[model samples]
Target: MKDLSYACSKFPAVSDPTADEVRRLRAEEKLSVRQIRARTGLGRNRVHELLRGVPPPEWTRRPNAKDGLRAEAVELRGQGCSVNDIAQRLGVANSTAYQWIRHLPLDADEETAARRRAHSKVMTDARWAAHRAARDEAQAATHRAAAGVVGALTERDLLLLGAAIYWCEGSKSKPWRRQDHVQFVNSDARLLGLFLRFLETCGVDRNMPTYRMSIHESADVAAAEQWWVHTLQLPATRFQRPTLKRHRPTIRYNTQEEYHGCLVIDVPRSRELYWRIEGLVAGLGAAIT
Candidate 1:
């Protein structure tokens, strides 16, 4: 009623309003003194003083331990405490404790370093000797076992069995070779018996009618067939006539009488059994090798 604008002009323009206006605005608009300063563009300190109230600043200050503590942390690490023990005392992670310890001296006394070097060398040598002895024993045992088994079979049987094993398990298969049956090529009788026994152990029926044989042309083919016939109790019809390979002068032919021949064992759908045998062979290979 008495000129409110002129009365308000007594105070600074950018500063807060008078107490009467502040009370009137607080009652009318329901704003705190800090909220009033934000809406009216008034100086923070002047607004609070004019409204007869105090307001805290918007930003907060955080406290940190000074460098004095870090220096002490480093000193504690040099006194020979382990990283775990240090971390526990300092209330820090093990990695942080290790970081502090890494700054310490790496040097140790000559006697202490020499003892560590000697101990390490001795342990390494002992481990090597143990492994060497085990390897030699395994090799000797494998050779003896193979020799005993092969000795029981005739020389012809050995060659045939070896050839069959090589064809089936050996890495000699070519893409052009159409023959998919299990074949072995070797002159060693003991190896042949071993292969047969290995097959028998893999659930191949001893009385299965699918068993067959084939031999080389150079050797006594009839005798070879008869021997397998008597041994496996199969008919002569199961034996395939030998395939003769002619000799060449340039090709080094060490064809000994001992080179009995090769053999082919026929079984319909033998692939499944072949896979099972493969797994069995693989398990034994580590010990054999």
Candidate 2:
């Protein structure tokens, strides 16, 4: 490279007060470039170019905001501090902290521990994945085991089960009303089918039971009526006018596409059958005890 002194001397120096005066004000007087220009009556560019070769005063070397932090990060890293530890203590971005000390060598033990920790994390993640797969397999196996325990239900089993179910869900005789009508209302298709089988077993005419659907006004009434008719295998004439319930402020979760609404099975003039079901429930309760 050309000598800086020789190259600097080539540029024409300002006159009147001269380049030495600008350098003197900048160094000894500790004045800024603008202050030097104002004090010496020289243009900003003239003063700046004149002082270009001159060594700046201590005040001119403005300390970077991160200078102290960078030094601390380097020192701390040499003393076994990790990047995260240095960043937090020095209040610098983790990436900036890493850049300050990444070239430094760590102690042998610290380097070994860092490698082991990284390996441990990978091992832990693999073990957790395996555990999750095993848990899913176990849950599926449990469901299959439980399903196998409950085999097909016999006719007698269904009769007892239906009677118990009807006792829980169907309308019963109350002291105030004295009504013993065989009115079974349910939303479950399986329960309704079993109840239909129960009615058949009792020698009741399937056509005699008048069907009605109780549903929200917002629901597809015609679709629900058709679904129930198809599901129950009943004649359209046997079905009565459906009862539409007014919409509440909060609707039910059953308002989805699969919701066909509750079916009401009313067997007219079945006071005797109602009494027999009540007796059957009573006998079942006594047997269980």
Candidate 3:
């Protein structure tokens, strides 16, 4: 109080050179907070306080692929575009697009008449139905035309075709051991029925063969047996107890309602019939050659 100038000279004032250095790097060097921290060893909060009111450089903003999308969403929201429209246009999920533009109010147009909104199931089906119908009709026409080409079969034709079918599908006697019985196993009901017709043509009794069903343990054996009986027009007594194949849960199988398993046709005392099938197969090979 006695002498202000004299007191000031006795004690020199101090300046924050650290703060000046931080500002210099931030403004002139255009270094990010991380870069400044690396260069100056200043704490993050301190550096941030020093950088207050100073906009960060573009590179320091951590721009990414979504930044453009966010900016576009904001613009769309300002224009009163629905979140649904924004999502479809931006190729983003509805929830994501909502997060981007939730602050904006939806317009009254969303409450318009239902006829114009094509969100209904009927409207969706209408668009593609005609095309599907036309394709189905064309396919059915081809099937009908092809079916007409195979008119009727004579007894000789049945004998040849059935013999070839038996050679391909029916079990044969191996050279290592002697098996003289006729055994045919097949899953297709049509093929088995055709084979039955072939047996009738050969003068073997229609009821001579023993039938058994091979099915998965997981399937309804009784239902399957009933299905076969109904399909073949054979008595339930004709079918032996089904041979249940072990079920492997890890592997997917045809276990649906329509999955009736293979039928085994075992004709006992058919050594003569087995030899006849071998001869027919030999004849086919020779005819083809």
Kindly list the per-residue Cα lDDT of model 1 for residues 1-289, writing each as its tens digit: 5778866768655733366576555566667667777777777776666656433333322245534545666777667565667778888888877776676642357786577669869998898998989999999999999888855656445444544465455433246964334544444455555665655655554454243344444557667666666655555665555666554445435456444455555555565554544554465566478
Model 3 residue 233 CA deviation in Å: 1.5
Candidate 3, superposed: residue stretches over 4 Å from native: 1-131, 251-253
> For residue 75, what is the lDDT in candidate 3?
90
Maximum-lDDT candidate? 2
**lDDT digits (tens) for residues 1-289 of candidate 2:** 6668966678766564587788888778888887888888989888879999877777767789888888878889878888888889988888998899889865557878889689879998897998889999999999999999979877777678778889999999999999999999999988998898888888876788999999999999999999988887877888888899999889478888998889999999999989989888989989989
lDDT of 3 by residue, 170-278 (tens): 8878889888778889999999888888887887765788899998988898989889888987767777888999977676658789899999988878999888878
Name the regions of candidate 2 deviating beyond 4 angstroms. Answer: 1-144
lDDT of 1 at 8: 71
Per-residue error for 91 in candidate 3, Å, reads: 14
Error of 1 at 73 (Å): 91
Worst 10 residues of 1 by lDDT: 54-63
Better of 1 and 2 by lDDT: 2
What TM-score number comes out for model 3?
0.55
